[model samples]
Target chain A: MKEIVVISGKGGTGKTSITASLAYLGGKDIVLADCDVDAADMHLLMQPDFGQAKDFYSGLIAEIRQDDCIQCGKCADICRFDAIPVIDGKYIVDPLSCEGCGYCPRVCPTDAIDMLDMNVGKWYVSTIKTGTTMVHAKLGIGADNSGKLVAHVKNEAKRIAEEEDKEIVLVDGSPGVGCPVVSSLSGAKFVVLVTEPTVSGLHDLKRVYELVDKFNIPAGCIINKADLNPQVSAEIESFLKQENIGHIASLPYDENFTAAMTQGKTIVEYDENNLNEILTQSWAKIKQIA
Target chain B: MKIAIASGKGGTGKTTLSTNLAAYLAEKQEVVLVDLDVEEPNSGLFIKAELLREEEKYKMIPQWNPDTCILCGNCQEVCNFHAVLKLGEQIMVFPELCHSCYACSELCPTNSLPMVPQKMGELKHFNSGTLSFIESRLEIGQEQAVPLIRQTNKYVEECFSEQVIKLFDSPPGTSCPVIEATKDADFIILVTEPTPFGLHDLTLAVETMRELKKNFGVVINRHGIGNDEVEKYCSAENIPLLARIPNDRQIAELYSRGELLYKKIPGVKEQLDLLIHHIEGLESAGER
Candidate 1:
């Protein structure tokens, strides 16, 4: 199956809006994957019927046994993160500050510290309006290992696509060149970078392009809000040409997108129908290139 | 006092609010704007700042010497990030995955591994008219940003003065990076729009703020463009409503061109002024 991951290095660049439209137009044999675990918003538009979520276990966390604590303060002194705290006459381990390095356990003479697996987040498989299996996740507030969560969601999407005999996996990637974005692009067949026409957009476009380039993935650029600044859009076009990345589409600055989103719909599903033609054309081009 | 402008969702005007608020606040007080979004720091692009200093941040990673090694594989076992690997007789080390916990070198039986400083990112200091700015730029392909963020905040804390009002432009999302950036802040400004996505992510951010036990307020950008769900949610949660930036094509265009709208947009300066007073009120109330 072909995998097309939609990414924007900067947030709020219409990655979800465009991805939802594409999934709506792509019709059958498509599995939608929302890999923006840190801020998964695709479900807001698709309004999927979510299934039971499974807990996601990531790195270990240190927990000190209260009964065996000797309050010698050796673990506190050696911890680089200062996770171990002497509180009220007993030593305690702060789960938020612990990095699961397996260091504090070694330094503890009383063997009180035990490294335990942490449930960092949860992933779900659901059905969207287009009858496509949508795989998404929610990373717990203040939790780490978003990259691993993205990987887990993608793997689930791939498994469902295989079982259902789906032909394509449409992925909605997260913002920034961080671990989660990297995981979304891992082993993907193609990448469509959705960016805006601003200095931050241009800079983010370059950074995410470099990240996709590192994985040697075939990628294309789709500039959203193209008319906001023609100069920056032109610069973005030239940059894509220099890098030989395909210029897939340039969507106009349309308020219809916001209107559609506010009504819990994609551009294709909205009653206004202003953004339908451009969105269909973009999906056609994406399918042809991807 | 340290105030952080943050949002669970991206593109909610954290940078816009921060840069403009800092510039306006500098007119009456000594202000410092620290952009903690090191992965994609764009605050530096909007502000015209004079270069004051730049320094490279580094972390210690174990460097294994093959000559002194017996290939015991103890270092490989102790590493949590899988930065070290043991082949038949060779050891492979991946520096990018290292967390600099020094567990590998400390656990090495033969003392073959030694800790060495490796470049992680850069911290920059700048003077933008009356405002002092600090930003961290992580090297491309780098995985972790918390260390660089910690180092930048360390510098800010060391030189902190009683007269300066510090504003932090935090990264999007309620993950570890956002937690690290806002941990020490006196107040947090959660920026959001009025859409469903905005409300969804704003709920997550509120959970984070409550977990941190930090006082916070909400700023609604692109108001009148979407539904009233966000305002309703804020009222239900009792989060103070600070300001509302109108949804106007003119404002979007101004933002696109990187113009400081506080200077030209009608009533924007006054709204920001009111926001400053609201924050001060919150602080004074907290003290009482």
Candidate 2:
């Protein structure tokens, strides 16, 4: 099966909205995976009928037994995150602050600390309105190991795609050049970069593009909110040309985008004529590559 | 008194509010502005400060010695963070994952492991005339922000005397990094716009500040363009609304040009001055 991963270099760049529109048009021919576990919002727009929530253990969370401990202050001193607290002459680990590094347990001379593999997140295999299977998850607040969770979601989606003989897998990846983004881009057929017309947007896009280049992924760019700053939009186009990246399309600002989100619907369902055509044509062009 | 300008979502003007507040406050009193968003440190975009000093700090992690090492795997088994992973025959260390707890070193059967410090990032001190801009730049692709933030606190404590009034530019989110930045701040100014997402995230920020037990007030940015959910939240929570800046095109243009908004908009300075004075008064009184 062919694969396409859509990502943006920055947050709030309209990656999910456009990805959902493409998924809507593509229908059951593909499987959808939202790998932005840190802030999973596609479910709000797609209204996916989520099913089978499984407790996912990513990293370990240190638990110190206060009764079995001495107030040596070694664990607190060694904890790089300051996750451990000195309370009433005792060291206690904040579940949220803990990175599960297990270093604290070793430093405790009294051996009062033990590592606990905490349930840090949950994953789901659901169906969006377009009759396509979707795998998405949420990383627990203040939790690490997002890259592992993304890989897990992608593996599940790939299994379903192969089982159903789907021809393509559409993934809505996270923003930035982080571990989670790396997992989403792993072995993907193509990457569609969505960006805006701003200095922050271009700077972040360049950063993420360098990462995509590191993986040798063939990529294209979609300049969203192109009209917001035409000068920046032109600069982005020139940058794309200089970098040998494909420029897919430019999108104008529309209040309907926000309206659709407020109504808990994809932009395609709200105004299928304009932006939907852009994704449709882009998908068709992407299909010709392989 | 320390005041942290924080927002739960990025691009909602965290840096914009913090830098302008710092610039405005520096005119009267000693002001220390901290850029805690180490992931993409940008407060220096406006505050032109001279480099004073720089230091490199790291989170301590157990360095395993192969000479005295036994492959008992006790350290690997005992580690909670999975920061230490025994892959095939080689032990791999993900520094970003390490919290420097020294567990592997203490648990090594052959006494082969020792906790050692490695440079993870740099903190630069900048003196811009009156305002002191303290910024910590974490190494790129490094996920150990909390450690750097902890180190950042040490720098702030040393540079910002108790008498100085400071404004800390916190990273967007109610996450661990934001928590680390705001833990010592005397007051928090939650900067937010008016939208469903804004309101949703702001509520989370408020919940976090409340849990931290820090005195907080709301600052409505782009006031008239959005809705009233944020105002209503503050009213119901009994948190005071400190200031409001309307959605003016000129102010937006100024920000786009990398200009400080408070200087461009006369409306902003008066509100900030009032807010700063009120915070000082509240701090002296020891009242929320």
Candidate 3:
């Protein structure tokens, strides 16, 4: 299967909106994966029928047995994190504060502390309105293994693609060039960077592009809300040319996108008779690389 | 009082506000601004701070005494993060994956684990006239940021005391690092845009602050651009909107060229001076 990832240098760049539209057009033929675990919102549009989520453990959380507890404060003292907090003359472990480093339980003089398995987060395989399978997940508050979660989603999407023999896989990537993004791009066919027409957008575009180029992934750029700043849009076009990243099309500033989101619909379905044409064209370009 | 300038989104002026707010308060007080956005620390770029000190921060990795031990696998079994593994009488520790949780040493059957320090990031100190700043830089590809942030904060706590005001440029979002930075602050200044995504993330940030029970106020950056979603949310939630920084390119342009907003706009400092006084008043009133 050929996979295409939709990413933006920054949030609110319409990356998820565009990716949902593509999934709609590819209905049943594409397995969708969302790599934006930190603040995933694609589900609001996709409406995946989440099923059978399993725990994904990544970070360490310290466990202290209370019976052996000596109030020596050794763990709290050594905890560079102050994760082991002392309150009301009693020592307690704050999971949110705890980095799960096993240090506190190890240094406990009473041997009362022991590390226990924790449910860091959950991942789901679901069906969206597009008749495509969606692989998504939610990272628990203070959970540290987002990269692993991204990998889980991608692996599930690939598995479904092979099982269904789908010709295309669409993945929605998050806003930063961090570990999660790196996991999303590993072994991806091509990347479509959705960006806005602003200085921050351009800077983010450069950062994400560097990541795409580092992996030698063939890529293209799609500017969302391009009419917001014509000058910046032109600057983006030139930057893409210099970097040889294809400038796909600049989507105009449209209230239809927000309206569609509020109505719990993808832009294509929300304005199928008109806006679908541009979305379809974008899909065609993505197919070329596929 | 130490206050942290934070936001739910990146480029929402965390660095800009932190640097300028640092300078704004530096004139009257011994202020230190610690930029804890280690991923992309940019506070120093705007301030003409003179370098004072730099130190690398590290996490402890357990060194194994294989000769004194049998591969009990207890370390692997107790490890929730998979940072430890035992195979065929061989126990291996992955330092990069380790959160320095010392569990292996604590649970070792033969007591074969010893904590050995491993470098993870660096902390830099600088002074911009009266304002001193500290920044933490996590090594690229290093996944652990909470430890470094906690280390950075601890360093600041130990190194300085009674700065009339202290500011922390926190990382975006309401996650571990963000929580670690703003926990002990006297006030939290949340800078946010007014877009849908902006409002959405801002809600999450506010929820975190409320959950942590910290007193906070809002600073609406890029004001008058998106909508009133943030205003509505803040008003309904009883959160205060401390200030509304208008949408201005002069600020963005100066930011791109590495300049603080207070430096570009003189009166902005005066306004922040009043804001600082307000915070001081609140602290005193709170004590009452």
Instruction: Encode model 2's per-residue lDDT on A183-283: one tens digit a residue.
Output: 89998999999988766677668877887888889999989878777788899999999998999888886656766765667777888778767767877
Q: Candidate 2 on B1-288: residue-level lDDT in tens?
A: 778888765556777788888888788877899888776676776778799999887778778677777677887886666778887766667766666766677667788778888887789999977889988876655555677877887888876678777778876655457777887888888887765556766776777787788788888877776457778888998989888877676665565446787766788887787777777788779744
Which residue pairs collide in model 1, if any? none
Which model scores highest in lDDT? 1
Residue A188 error for model 2, in Å? 3.8
Chain A alone, TM-score for each of the models?
0.97, 0.94, 0.93
Looking only at chain A, give the TM-score of model 3 against the true structure.
Answer: 0.93
CAPRI accuracy category, model 1:
high
Better by lDDT, candidate 3 or 1: 1
Error of 1 at A235 (Å): 1.3
- lDDT for B256 (candidate 1): 82
What's the distance in Å from true for residue B178, model 2? 3.0
DockQ of each: 0.80, 0.32, 0.20
The reply for model 1, stretches above 4 Å from the true place, is A271-274, B285-288
